[model samples]
Target: MSRVRLLFLSLVFLVAGSVQADVVNKNVDTAVDISTQLVKIAHKVTVENVGKTPVKSLIFGVPAHIKERLSFISAKVGEHQLRLSETKVDNQEGGFWKLELRSDITAGRTLPLSIDLVLGRGLIPHPSQITQKEKQLVLFEGNAYYFSPYLTEKQTLTVNLGTSSVESFARVQPVSQSDTKITYGPYEKVAPFKEERLNIHYENNSPFLTITKLERVIEVSHWGNIAVEETIDMEHQGATLKGPFSRYEYQRETQSGIASVKSFRTALPASAVDVYYRDDIGNISTSHMRVLSDSVELELRPRFPLFGGWKTHYTLGYNVPSYEYLFNQGDQFVLKMRLMDHVVDDMYVEELTTKIILPEGCHSIELTAPYSVKRLKDTLHQTYLDTKGRPVVSVSKSNLVENHIDDFELRYTFAKVLMFQEPLLVIFAFFALFLLVIIYVRLDFSITDEEENSRVEREQKDK
Candidate 1:
């Protein structure tokens, strides 16, 4: 038997022996935040096991219609986060996920669970196009009841629109509106797989900027520097501008373009230095930077105001001290950095690709991401004084929100002596050049000694 076959059999048995449980949601309270472009949902669930056996894990689900809008989801018990994996439940087709609890719950026992979800592209512009003076209104459609596999004994939902200027909302029974918040049902004994469309149409004049594409490159140097550069392509995904833009009218009215984006703030590390923000034209001097105690805040303003459907592209870069993110103890080095940093508040990123370039002569590379990301094939990148080229690890993800901002760790092995490789190469090149010069001066290149003596005689005569 080959080792490969043996390992395959081991994995098959390991999965077959896993535990399954039957649990019910005793009570659920959900809150939806639609103040900005992104939709944030938080659920506080009280779960109880109804089966005779112990329940080691629980399954959570999202409706198939809106599954593509979900960008991030997490379940926590107390302060500890549980591990969730995508799985398929029998006779069901949706975004089904299973999470293992910290400890198993016996029959008739209860446990409290906290689940949070960040959804992108959830709020869509109602009219899809508007003039400069009109307020931006969006429509949000979601489930009225908690979408769960098991029967929910009691559940309630609250929608916070963060604005009192409302248009219309779904009139589900036992629903009330108070200021910017809408409350729905303390309904009882909800059946499994039940869904009721909840719609809210309201005014949201917030900036609806979205990053269509982002390419982040992090280059590491053993000489105590780590350089990061991000190329961003941004688009205003809100209502499209209907008429021609009028700069003079926009300047006259203070609230001419309420939904138009003029500027946004970006945060960097406290130790970040030599920061630059530029575009294809050249440096943009309209930006401002303020150094805070915990971070460096940069206010980026494009050349023109970003109206609906307008687009802009820029490149932002900075350098941080290697000691802050890179750590090494006797050869093995670990680099901890953010997978995706903050682009703007409540920002939605359509596509994100991150690349990390390690120093030359590094080997035994390992990567640990906070969430699942599609890892691309590793390649080599050659730069100045690079002999064998640096190893570049690339990973990509889509539909990312602000909640996805977290650290990813990379580990690699590099001998301390390899740090001197570039300096040594420089020294050897100079030494070889000097040796060649010495040999060239001493060599008698004349075809004959008579020709050499005649050249010397001509030089003396001229003098």
Candidate 2:
């Protein structure tokens, strides 16, 4: 053959070989339903060489979103199993590739790829076992898709929801297709599997309240006392009342059925004394207190049952004796106290102002917080004969969830001399003023003598 003919033949062979090497057998299995909180996706890819010559390697690509929830469960190619490693290919979010078989593929060979993925709404994993009695499970209804040019074949997706029968209205739609069709369970009446209920009904009796404004002032007086005041604007997020609520009906229902809305139960530290819970107008008489040696528990029964979207504001104050939170470390004084407790739900702390009043001569004011703070502002607050003024720290956090409460800590330091400086200044100032008044009176002429002399002088002048 001529050199030109040989070159053309070589080119044709190379093109054919590349096409054969790129061919892959792909299988995708996907399961999704509202009954389960999550969707499971499994993919298997197999590569086989039908050409006469052996190919060196094969490259497999997966969708970006697919990799987020989907993990490589296992993979195998021929007798040698392939180990899968993830690598970013492009700047695109979900761009990744799996490299297999770096060497040439022998004639009539096959390589397999297997991967298992668990996909869901967010990074937080859905609860595995949801109890029906808890009434906390929410069905997750969403769509998922798989795309690959290598796998031109379409596979049917299967979804099963254990014992609970699939709702006849449940619909499934393919990503590429706009039309959706309702389908029944593939299997007939089978044994109900012990699966967590996707829908649950439970007693949610806890009142959901938010503390719109919280002002905690720690005033260190020369006289030993730390005062803590909390103002809370609480609201109820329970089932609303339809039409008018009848007292007779309510009482009957209370006797027969369980209450859906949560009630208020506030627990204070054992050392907490002089606890009080009052509403905007005045004290709520329904509240009761139980004090034990270890801790104090206050039961605050609102005047009315809090339903969904109903709001009530209340103020609570308690004074902790000086020795409880204030401690003497060598010459320095340390004041430590618990700010708030967990258990409180929907706690939207719009503004938290904390004033730490140190003794008059105390120095070196430092503040630290244990919890992650959204925003914080600090300033000096002078009040009540304070020479250098007290340091006030303000923290503001928005859209705060419940879990963040456990991680919060606030710490600060101040000089110990203020412990005595404030008291001495107040006492000496009052005493000095009293003595000055007495001395001025004694130096002046007597009141009676002055009055008599003035009268006699007036008589002589008149004569």
Among all candidates shown, the one with the greatest lDDT: 1
TM-score of 2: 0.51
Question: TM-score for every candidate vs. truth?
Answer: 0.89, 0.51
Give the lowest summed-lDDT range of ten residues in model 1: 12-21
Candidate 2 Cα errors over 4 Å, as ranges: 1-206, 210-225, 239-262, 292-294, 321-339, 343-363, 407-413, 440-463
Worst 10-residue stretch by lDDT in candidate 2?
188-197
Q: Number of the top candidate by TM-score?
A: 1
Candidate 2's displacement at residue 120, Å, is 18
Relative to the true structure, how large is the alpha-carbon lDDT of every model? 0.89, 0.47
All models, RMSD in angstroms:
8.5, 14.1
lDDT of 2 by residue, 269-374 (tens): 6776777778877887787788878767777776665544556677777777777777666655556664444325333344454445555455554445544354
- lDDT by residue (1-463, candidate 1, tens digit) is 4334433433332223332325567799999999999999999999987668988888888888668789889999999999999887665556888998889999879999999998898899988999999899999989999987776778999999999988999998899999999999998767666788888999999999999999999999999899999999999999999999999889999889989998999999999999999999999999999999999999999999998899999999999999999998899999999999998999999999999999998999999999999999999999889878999999999989998999999999999999889999999999999999999999986599888899999999999
